[model samples]
Target: MAASYELKASARDRVGKGAARTLRREGLLPAVIYGDKKPALPITIPLKETTITLHKGGFLTHIGVIDVDGKKHQVIAKDFQLHPVRDDIIHVDFLRVSKGATLTIEIPVHFLNEEDCPGIKKGGVLNIVRHTVEMTVPADNIPESLEIDLAKAQPGDSLHISAVNLPEGCQPTITDRDFTIATIAAPAGMKETDEDETEEEAEGEAE
Candidate 1:
């Protein structure tokens, strides 16, 4: 499930690069809350607190409540800008989420039972194709990560999106086909030996 947090911000009366810089000088981060058919609200949140939340992980997917001058708004971080040199979060754009709204976000993938996986047990390498899958999920019900079980995975077997059991309303953005997420790949030498064995078997049969 998606986690939630709160942020305290002061309503900003100014907008533009100069105003943003001024806020930064005052140890605050400039931010805006828009979307959901409402006018954009400019605000400034404490730099220290916002930075802590940003580093906590899953900032984009987690729901946040921003209190602007005591007026609270439920929002999700849609975008954030970083300083090219300093690498600090300079600005943030949050989108207001209404009830029953579905959002397109990336959910991280987590692998399980690698030790017991038939492929890994045979020294097969687990090659990850996609680290995160873009999914269309409900705003109120976001999953932290999508898990893949490798207990039965065999060497050279491909794990596809069809293998995951998504949440009730969660759906992958790619609808065309069952995409490959990971693979249990055979080592180069193992593949070569297997090919040679197959060829020798074929030659003996022909004799």
Candidate 2:
């Protein structure tokens, strides 16, 4: 699970391109909090603090308690706009989420025990098909990443999404079929050698 955070923001009295530009000039970023069957609220936050949070990473995946004019809203950063040349966050959109709401997010996949895997130890290459898996999870129980154990994985073994152990209340969005996540394949040199041996065998049979 990701750690929670609190962001301080001031309610915006005016909302428009002009007002947003003025706030940016004053070193503030314009933001909006909407959803949960409530009216959208326009707000502004400190540019410095927002920049630091963005640099820390996982702002979109983690839930944050946003304080706007003494009122708190549990939300997640859904979308953000950045200045093309300056690479600054100009505007952001926050989606209010209830505790029991189910949300879809792409969680990163972390492979473990690669050193102990017989395939990897025997010069096999690990080919990753999906670096991240999209899943539907409760708002408050989002996982940081999914771990896949490769302790017994061997060469020519393909790992599918069904092999992963997900946390309770977390389900993959892709439920139609068991998609492959990774594979332990033979190295290019090994593949070439096998092809050469097959060709030699075929020539010997033909002769």
Candidate of highest lDDT: 1
TM-score, cand. 2 vs. native: 0.84
* lDDT per residue (tens digit) for residues 1-207 in model 2: 233778899999998889989998999889999999999999999888988898888887899888998998888888889999999899989999886798888889999998899989878989999999999989978888888899999878899988999999999998999999999998777788989999999999999
Best by TM-score: 1
Model 1: runs farther than 4 Å from truth? 1-3
Model 2 per-residue lDDT at 198: 100
User: What's the C-alpha lDDT at position 135 in model 2?
Assistant: 91
